[model samples]
Target chain A: MTQLQGAAPLGATVVAEHGPTDPRDQRPVRGRKKVGIGKVIAWIVMVIILVITIFPFYWMLRTALSSNGALYGNSTSLLPADFSWGGFERVFGLQTVDEAIAQGGSGAKLDFWRYLLNSVVVATCVTVFQVFFSAMAAYAFSRLRWRGRNAVFGLFLLSLMVPVIFTLLPNFLLVRQLGLIDTLLGIMLPSLFMAPFAIFFLRQFFLNVPHEVEEAALVDGASKVRVFFSLIVPMSAAPIATISILTYITSWNDYFWPLMVSYTDDSRVLTVALGAFRAQSPQGGPDWAGLMAATLIAALPMIVLFALFAKRIVNSIGFTGLK
Target chain B: MAITSPGVAHSAPNGRTSVDARRRRPDDTKLALLFILPAVIGLVVFYFWPLARGIWLSFTSWDLLSPSQLIGFANYQRMFADPVFWNAVQVTLWYVVLNIGIQTIVALVIAVLMQRLTQSTFVRSLILAPFLVSNVVAALVFFWILDFQLGIGNQMLEWIGLDRIGFFTSEEWAIPTIALVNVWRHMGYTALLIFAGLQAIPANLYEAARVDGASETRMFTGITLPLLRPILGLVLIISVIGSFQVFDTVSVTTGGGPVNASRVLQVYIYENAFAQFDFGYASALSVAMLAILVVVTFFQYRITRAGQTDLN
Candidate 1:
């Protein structure tokens, strides 16, 4: 029944049932060999749906690898047309202005390397600090018995309902007044310390932790802070790691707030950079090859991360979605 | 002791009364305050303060250059009179309806299929791949694929001897195109959420029904649908609230264009706030959006009874 709530326990059960699970194992269910016509039809439909879901990603790669001039003539080709690394070269500013223009690029340097660095910095700072601070608050809310704890936590939870757009204007103004506008600091400030979701997620985990361990630590003269650091933090590492990954992805993918805060390549993240790149369509139309290359590059980090931590990320989605 | 130790007897072991255990601890209030101070400070300064200031800024007129002057519902009055605002509201609602409707149905089918058939992690990961990328990437990829002249989508249509459709360029197709793009991005994630709920349904129920000679369709309608209501309700509310704030995709693809056909509320508010520098009016619009979401959420909660579960 623990499977009813979270993916973690489900994953654990799977691991126990099948030793050292392989993600590629596509074995059908045991004792379910009665493949009716209906089942075959279902499998066909599922495959078709899967193809539809995955085809665009393939198309993006195909277009990115193709030359811009060749894309117009071979629009429907399955493979890359006039295959070249020119699109990626243009995105990385490896091509000279004339070379870029010759390849149908805007010839305007994208500063993609700078934006990528900016994204790394902003996402890392926001994820590390937000998760840490939220965990501390979660510990207070869940483990400690204190006056006004539930009320304060409830107030934090209520803020979740306040759509982020409602606060955008004021927060933008505040960031500006703090002289953080057009800086990485501005992009990171609003989300730097805590998120209600992070707190709620951690608090739920903390609530289930038996108090006896903490009580034992206290009896041995450890402070509450020490107990939290030494006991709770290590014990709840899984939830903490889960929250960190989620926060990192969110921060990396964030467009709106960063779009408002970041104006130049110095602080502009990949998402905003991609948006700006698309908006500035030179002569004939957008540099399709270059644009696709940049989009793919921008999405690469997250894709790689998802690939590495697919199980953990997938499991956490169940927990987050239900919340 | 009686009042303080209502239900916490387990912690007081080894001849320690609950009151004695409590007395051994340092001041919890001070420790809690210390623990929560950083998050609380951030929440107040960034979230709570901004929320209040946004509400206040709504009632005043500020153009960034001058001091905000009290305008007393002038922004709200202007919004009510503004056709563009109404058009934005309409476009947003239409987009939400399309997004939620299509996303929900597709996700449900996908979820049911995954539950009944194989449980391949590879398949689940593939379904969730689109969601991992940012909206900008999804929009750009789709925009290129769905371009009017040179797009592969149009090329395929022409191959079928059908007239090419202007996906983002035509008003008729802009909202739907944007909606569909987002649907592609979100449906898999939503399906996973529903799939989790489906996992919770007991196999005994199915076996019991099978023994009673119930058909698959009959069991699905009778057991699966009823059991999945709480999850479905929660997913719907989450999806609807998210769909209403559709900004990134539309902003990237159409910029609310082909003539205001996809000018979602967020886009309109952003334009007023940043482009026009009409912060006051933008604040009012945001307040309006917030009110709508709150009311909608309340109604959805009441209608879905999302808080209640049939499992127990």
Candidate 2:
């Protein structure tokens, strides 16, 4: 039991069937600490790269804050000189941000609020359905003693490789026939409802759940559904959280389908709206400050989430991909 | 997803099947079906149904504007004969090549750099911020930066001694620009993946290499790189699949460009289905792309799996 203490945290040591019996893995391997020039050089390179990676985002926020008139000015400085809430002012589509909010507009005619609301609705609905169904399917695949399970899973895996383009016309036609165009339901139905990857990922998670626990639940008179929702759901937080974040982000940022299906601003999500805005810009092109502002706003929610859950998100990609 | 044996194989210490569950399972088949009904129905409706429709649609002449003619293989034949489709094919290949090449190199480098960090977790998350910014938003951000006059790239170039480069307008630079934008957004995800693979690896492997007094290059060539084969293969395969389906980015950034330089397969399909309403041709094109992707991905999986080791 003591041997499970130091196996490179998050790279959690494989606790075997013997229930954590390995002594060699139990001792912490304090990795070599660097010193002098090597340490300084490594740190310097790290900082520089971090700056480069983060500079685009920094520039984005700075550009968002820059005045429309001042943006055209040759400014080498990272920080905007003439900073105002002008871009925010423009997004609200009023003389001031407050005035724009008082009206129907969130900040502008097509500011953050409407699009944010659309995104929230789409993402939330997509996540809930995708996760729930994926979980149930995953449970069945992982637990059910059904015939042709391997073949079914293999087919589903093949579905993962089939790109969205292959399914586009068919889905579009289906939606059109159903008269779901320009509806939130249209965008959600094709993708968010059920993804093969979601099933695959959750199945991987479900496979890891020790069978004894579920057996215990079964012995205690729990049905499969009860065991799943009550037992597995609680213990499956890591993978569930991972999938939820993934589904939520993917849904929020979805572009191609939304662009293809929706015609009006009513059903238009952030991606499609931003896409059309780019398409219709004049020869002089899109307003840099305003566009950047809009992009920043659209990206803000996920950014905050990523910042808060960076570890899980990073590890989630690794985890989900590996699964 | 560390799935070992599944939960169904649950057995007691005495090797008897766990009791009480099956005895009480009410209408067993019905209950199982009830639990799985939503998923089964969902797959049939969303996936299987659409796939079947798409396959069937490929067999007929169903242009949105025209009468639904039952023309078998003609759409496929026309696609094969058309140079336009071939151009789209070439652009698609270019996009895939560029995405794989740039993202692989950048991801490897970033992964290596990230591995060197004393604080990898924060850096890993920081690097992955781009992944959250969806294709549309990322493209819009880049679109603004690559605008004809107001573009930051041109603006910066003008400030320097160099001439302002027409990133989007120029045929030569347009495809590369879009590919670069994709690489920028996705490289971090690949890097994170590689880092996870790296982190997952037992430190003793490196320690053993160090005991042998191996050089850093030798250590990487011997231990780190080889160990990362499975994950690297995954990243490569996914990048290839994703690159071929490059749509939202290109559509948002260049709209298939000034002279069709950036017109990838998905973009071409979109152009056919949505833009031109040639559903027959579009269906044929989609079928062709899917066939190619399936074949390519199969080989990729085989090769990658072949290279995989039982190191973990």
Candidate 3:
């Protein structure tokens, strides 16, 4: 137990599973701590890399804040010289490019708010349905005894290798044939059910739950359905949440399918909108400040979600790998 | 994903299944099917059926408007003969090669450094920040930052009195630029994987090597790298698979580029299917992609299986 305590301080379940277990894991030398050149070098390297990783977002924010004149000005200032909210206003439709230009401001005419709402709706539905359906299937694969179970599971594993592109064109045809084209439902229905990777990841997590716990519930006259809802769901919240976040991110970031199906602003998501918005700019190129503002607004939810769940997201990736 | 026997066999300990448990097996099977029905229906409709139909679509001349005509192997022949297809294949392979090389080295180095730190959530989160952003956003950010005219990248070059390079407008520089953005977006996830592998290595091995007066570089080469083989293999396979399907980045930024320099396989397939309304040809291209992936995945599984050790 002490060894487990010393294994990892936070996000320990994933690390604990992968952590060295044998006594040979312990070092002969211990209990010495001081600053060293190696430590300094590591910090320096980390700091430098961190800056590089973060600078792009900082630049996005900085550009989003600048006025159009300031952005295309002769001098490229290191700071936001002409900071304003006009770009974001154009994005939200509180102001339009014509209105801004008429008043000597720069803006773009985009259905940013509509796209944001569509992204949220699609991502949320995909997350909820994908998690529920995956959990149901994972439960069967991990705990229940059944005929042809291994065969069906094998099909799932095999399909994992089939690059989504192959299914994509045919599936698009399927959706179009069903007369579901140009609708958000067409964009959402294909992937909203369950994914092979989600099922596999969840199944691995479910397999780790000991048999005794479920047996105990069964002995108390609990049906399999009862046991699943009463015991499995409660015990597997961590992994379920992890799967939910992953699904939401993937669905929100999804561009190709949405781009294929959605043509009008009524159904277009942020990613597709961003692309259309870019192409709609005047001859000189996109309005850099307004474009940056739209980009930030599109990315803000994910960045915030990532910030909040950084540890779990990392651990989920580790857990998926270890399996 | 392999269905091992342990979970089932372990439940009945001592090789003894009571008569009651044996009798209950049928009920378990029934309940299992019930629980699995929703997903199974989805898989048949969306996954397996589409895969089989995609193959059939590949043989037919199904443009979006007209009915499909049965013309077996014609799509393949046309694809093989087409210069654009060949260019796409060349572009995709080169992108995969360069992407894997850059991502593996950068990720491994970052992982090694991260493993040395005691408390690294903040730093790790910063590294992971880009990974969370949608690829479109990442491309857009890079699109502006690497803009030939007002780009910070070129601005910095001007500050240093160096020639401003054409990032997306030039044939030679475009693909590599896109590949670099791909690396920047994904390196953190791979680093975390390798970092996890590092943590699982027993410390006594390092201590023993130190007792023998081994240099740090020797210890790294002799122990760390070898122990990291499995995780590194996983990273390599994943990077290769992902790089091959490069679409969003290319579409949003280059749109297959300044002279089709970055016309990756996915973008190429997409254009054929949607833009040109050549569903059969698009399906053929997708099949080609699947074949390449299958071969690559087979070799990866074989190599990893052969070099298998008790990773944990």
lDDT of 3 by residue, B52-73 (tens): 9999999999877877899989
Candidate 1: residue B280 Cα off by (Å): 0.4
Q: Taking the tens digit of each residue's C-alpha lDDT, what string does model 2 give over A1-323?
A: 12223434322212111111222333333265655576577678767767756777877888888765666664445787478676666664545646533321233355557777888898999999988888887887776655666776676676665577767788888898899999999988876557787887777667767777987888777777788888888888877887888888888888888888888877888888777655655344355666777788888999998887776666566544433
DockQ scores for all the models shown? Answer: 0.42, 0.40, 0.47
- Clash pairs, candidate 3, are none
Candidates in descending DockQ order = 3, 1, 2
Of the true interface contacts, each candidate retains a share of 0.50, 0.40, 0.51
lDDT of 1 by residue, B1-312 (tens): 011111122333446434534885458889899999999988899899999999999999999899999999999999999999999999999999999999999999999898778687778888888998999899999999999988989988999999999999999899999999999999899998887777766666676677788888988888788778877888888888888888999999999998888898999999998899999999999999999999998899899887566665
- What residue runs in model 1 are displaced by over 4 Å at the alpha carbon? A1-33, B1-21
Report how far residue B133 has shifted in candidate 3, in Å. Answer: 0.7
Q: Write the per-residue lDDT of candidate 2 for residues B181-281, one digit (tens) a residue.
A: 88889888887667656655667766766787887788777767766676677767767877788888888778887778888888888888877778878
Give Cα-based local distance difference scores for all models.
0.84, 0.72, 0.79
lDDT of 3 by residue, A177-295 (tens): 99988788999998877888888777866777777787767767788888789898889888788888888998999998899988798789999998887776655556777789989
- Model 1 scores what on Cα lDDT? 0.84
**Candidates ranked by TM-score:** 1, 3, 2
Q: Mind sharing the TM-score for model 3?
A: 0.92
> Which structure is stronger by lDDT: 1 or 2?
1
- Worst-scoring 10-residue span by lDDT in model 3 chain A: A1-10
